[model samples]
Target: MRQTPDCVLDRPSVDDLDQFFSIVSDPRVWTHLPSGRLTDEEEAEAILVRLVFADRGLTAAQLGARLA
Candidate 1:
């Protein structure tokens, strides 16, 4: 039988900050953001904090990314 994992997924831990930076650091994803590319690591960290903090009611927001 096929099963699904229905539990809510927790936010990625701080140890994964580099992965977070890769997302926010890209200018394309920041098209709606004022700062284009992330200011730096600290700024990227802040964005992560906010994303997990804000209750924008998205099961998942579709931000763009490219995997190489």
Candidate 2:
């Protein structure tokens, strides 16, 4: 886990959905990404689920370390 003066860098989890949604739902946050800002909570939820739980071959700890 890395900590800067302003924030900590770590793997995100399901519990972080609300905070994650708050950030990504903002239009400015998606300006450089391939897609536009998420339109609603349901959309955000689906995306987060796939990202955190889908079988991408990495174990949870491996995923967390890479993300961190």
Candidate 3:
């Protein structure tokens, strides 16, 4: 994690579950997404585990390849 006078930047983890859920479940977030907002904390946790945390093992090159 990196912190500066402006803000702190860090990867999402179990520790961020609550905040993550709050953000993901907000209707404002759905405005730009074709997908629906997360329904609850449980759903958020599942998404984080399946999508976010699962990507942590990849290297930059692997991530780039996946993106490509």
Candidate 4:
């Protein structure tokens, strides 16, 4: 997690499944997404699982890493 005075930013994990589903399933969010919004909780969970595992090899700091 990264925190500044204004807010805290966290990486997506299984713990955020509900919030992730709520945002992605919203109609407004769907309109802007080419893949469209999530269809159901199960689908959201699957996606989140993939996301969580996909990030397992990286750290938050490395998200901004570059070659020197």
Clashes of each: 0, 0, 0, 0
TM-score, structure 2 vs. true: 0.60
Query: Which candidate wins on TM-score?
Result: 4
lDDT tens digits by residue: candidate 2, 1-68: 79999999976767879988998798788778837688789888767755776545666677667757
Once model 1 is optimally superposed onto the true structure by TM-score, how far is the C-alpha of residue 5 displaced, in angstroms?
A: 9.3
**lDDT on C-alpha atoms for all candidate structures:** 0.63, 0.76, 0.76, 0.77
**Per-candidate TM vs. native?**
0.44, 0.60, 0.64, 0.71
lDDT of 3 by residue, 24-66 (tens): 9888989988378888788888677555636677655665576
State the lDDT of candidate 4 residue by residue for 1-68, as single tens digits: 99999999999888998899999888887776747887789999877876776577754455335212
Q: List the candidate 1 regions with Cα displacement exceeding 4 Å.
A: 1-10, 46-68
User: Deviation in angstroms for 52 in model 2?
Assistant: 1.4
Those runs of model 2 whose alpha carbons end farther than 4 Å from true positions after fitting are 32-35, 54-68
- Predictions: Cα RMSD each: 12.2, 7.0, 6.7, 8.4
Candidate 4: residue 64 Cα off by (Å): 28
| Per-residue lDDT of candidate 1, residues 1-68 (tens digit) | 34458666555655668988988788778888856777599987756755653544333332221111
What's the lDDT for residue 44 in model 4? 90
lDDT of 3: 0.76
Q: List the residue pairs that clash in candidate 1.
A: none
